[model samples]
Target: MQTILSRVLKNSTFITSIISILLGILVGAIMMIMAGYDPILAYNALFASALLQPYDLGETIRTITPLILIGLAVALAFRTGLFNIGVEGQVIVGQLVAVIIGLKLGLPPVLHAVVAIIGGGLAGALWAAVPGLLKAIRGVHEVIVSIMMNFIALNLSNVLIRRWLAQGTDSTPEIPESASIQMDFLSQLFGGARVHVGIFIALVAAFIMYYLLWKTKLGYELRAVGYNPLASEYAGMSVKRNILLSMMISGSFAGIAGAAELLGTSGYQSIQATFTGIGFDGIAVALLGANTPIGVILASILFGVLTYGGGNMQFEAGVPFEVIRVVFAAIILFVAANISGPLVNLFSKRRRDKHRARHLD
Candidate 1:
């Protein structure tokens, strides 16, 4: 454990993230003081409510489950030099497909859940393939195509759910027991906080992503293409194929995130007036985690804590939940600025100067 902690501390990205988080907290405190609130009390209440109880901790984990998957989705794209902003759309489509399969399929328990989850992922991949095709074949930018696809996915999903599954209802049918990811023992342990098998699925997905990106030939090609399409093509790599594959893989993870949410938490797809903000939230997680698999998981946990604890902070300390959001925003902004790189450079320069001075003396 100590070795792991030491390595994490030594990682420049991780150190920078810590600095950003501390600065964010400091900003939050300033805001709270300006508004006549007690920052310490509010933060204490947040932590207490989020960690001091089994239920709270369980709820935080449950919230984290899908975020971890979504974070992985975005992080994978980041590593491969793709901004898969369409993950929102991919997740929506995945949710719709998972609900349809869960409601209609009649397989055995474990098998049914597996099928539904995979079905959702497949749906997301297909949905993402459109933008991928456009980008790969037509030389169109993915950001534009993916953003447009998000609107299409939202409205198209609404239409499909209403016409095919709902047929005059406001929501799709509840997921059958066969397709539910909920585990009785886990639920019991958490006092019915709705944690499920999705966490394990998310962790496994992270491991798969890590292994695929760092340990496989295909991973090398994908990353190589992302690093320099011209060089990769000169090396006989198929840039277009890698681009399409990367988007599809990213979308698959997002879709799995959607399926996990429905199967493990919500159990049904309601008519959405808006895209679930969770997809956009993944961008922050990816940034904060430095687009690494382990970073995504750790970042998801931090986000979950802040998100779940915000309400308690509001109630106990009379601070608005929006303040917590502000802190999150601040952290993301700082991370985006790449503050850690500059800080590291400054520290290195200072060390060099000190060494030169000592040698001269």
Candidate 2:
């Protein structure tokens, strides 16, 4: 068991994530003590609410579903050497398109849902394609273009929601039942929490991403370009084309996240005064997950637990929920500092030296 644990801890990414989380917890405890709160009681309430209660657990899962998708979006962009700060815009466009299609299309239940979801993803892909094209063709920095596009998408979504698609208010009408992703059995099983079949969708998406990134030729080209675009271009790869493709794929994940949130949970699309922080939060998710599909899923679940439980902590311990955000920020800071890299190297070197001594003996 010890050997197994040692092998697992030898993985740099895993070790880094664990260390970051531990440091985050320690810092959070210190902050709570400074704020005149009992850290142990606060954390107990948080865990009890988020994990031990059925309704809260379901809500945590609901939060995890979209986070998994958005995390994948950010991870994909990072792997392709692009900063996709426009996931918020992609999500907005996706939700708008899904709402429109769900309202207008009359079809069989399964077909309607599928079409609406796909349509939303396509809209997100198109929305992101603009920035991708500018970056690829005009040599404009993608980060700048994506940020500008975010504002455009937000304003456009607001206009469409209020004027064009609004039933009477700043939101579209509840989508047709056929287009919903709600699962009655799961809801009942979870004590009427809003958990839905979207969790399954998120899982499938993660599997697909894993397969695409590790098993496909196209993925190789994309990663190769990311590592060195000039070298890839010299090797006869289309660097520009790969950039566009990567952005579209990344945006599609964000679009699916929007679809899941609207069709699976909210049942209606509402205009937002500001961007939902999910897209931005996805950056942290991808960072902590080390840009891997499995890592993203695990990290998303952790985030979901923290987010859902933070409310309970606040209510029970009189601690501010913003402290959860502070914890998260601390974790990100530690990860960025590469605190675990040296530790990992030191352990590996010690292990190798021990093996060499054993062989000589």
Candidate 3:
């Protein structure tokens, strides 16, 4: 049992993630106490609200639908040694494109939905390609370009929506039923919650990403370039092409997240006063998950639970909902600290020294 425990603890990344979560919870409890709230009661309410009811569970799953895709997007980019700060822009562009296609295209129900979703993915890929191309060709920093593109995408989406699709209000017309991703059976199963078939789509996407990154030659090239661009280039790989490909792929995942939101839930694109923070939250998700596909899925679930349950905490315990965000922020900070490796190493060294002394005796 001791050997098994030590072996499990030796996984520094897992240990770090777990420790970060526990520490974040501790910090949250301390804050709750300082604020004159019972931390245990607040947390109990949160968990009860989120998991003890079918409706809230469905909503939690729905919320994580986009988060899963966005987390995967950021993780993919990180694995390729790129930071895709423009997932927000890509999502905006993709949502606009999806709405346009759903409104304009007339086809069979399944075909129409499929085409609109694909259009959204393509738009995101194209939008991200610009930054990738600039980074590859002109040596422009991707972070700067991506951030600027986010602003541009926001403005452009508003302009296009108003000019072409906006109804009496700031949002586009409701998408046709044919293009909707909602399934009546799924909703019924979840006690009439608005959760849709998009959750399954997200699962499939995660599997696809895992396969693409781990099983394919193209993925190998991309990973190689990410590991060492100079070495990859010396080995006759096209670093520029791989960079562009990585951004496009990453953008596609974010774009699909937008499509899922529109077709599965919102059914229309609204002009936003501010960028939706899903893309930004995705950064934390990726970090917490250690940039792996499976890790992203699990991290998305944790975020989903916290976000969906926060309202209940406020309602039932009078705790501020923003406390959830604070906990999430603390988790991100600890994960970024990367302190688990040294702790694990120290423990392993002590164990080795003790074993040596026993042998000498």
| Among all candidates shown, the one with the greatest TM-score | 3
Error of 2 at 108 (Å): 2.1
Name the TM-score of candidate 3: 0.96
Number of clashes recorded per candidate: 0, 0, 0
Clashing pairs in 2: none
Task: Score candidate 1 by TM-score against the native.
Answer: 0.95
Better of 1 and 3 by TM-score: 3
C-alpha RMSD of candidate 3: 1.4
Q: How many backbone clashes can be found in candidate 3?
A: 0
For 123-175, candidate 1 gives per-residue lDDT tens digits of 88888888888888998988899999999999988888888888589888888
* Model 3: lDDT to the true structure: 0.90
Query: After superposing candidate 1, which stretches have Cα over 4 Å from the reference?
Result: 1-11
Clashes of 2: 0
lDDT of candidate 3 over 211-314, digit per residue (tens): 98899999999899999999999999999999999999999999998988888898999888999898899999999999988899999999999998988899
What TM-score does model 2 achieve against the real structure?
0.93
What TM-score, over all chains together, does every model reach?
Answer: 0.95, 0.93, 0.96
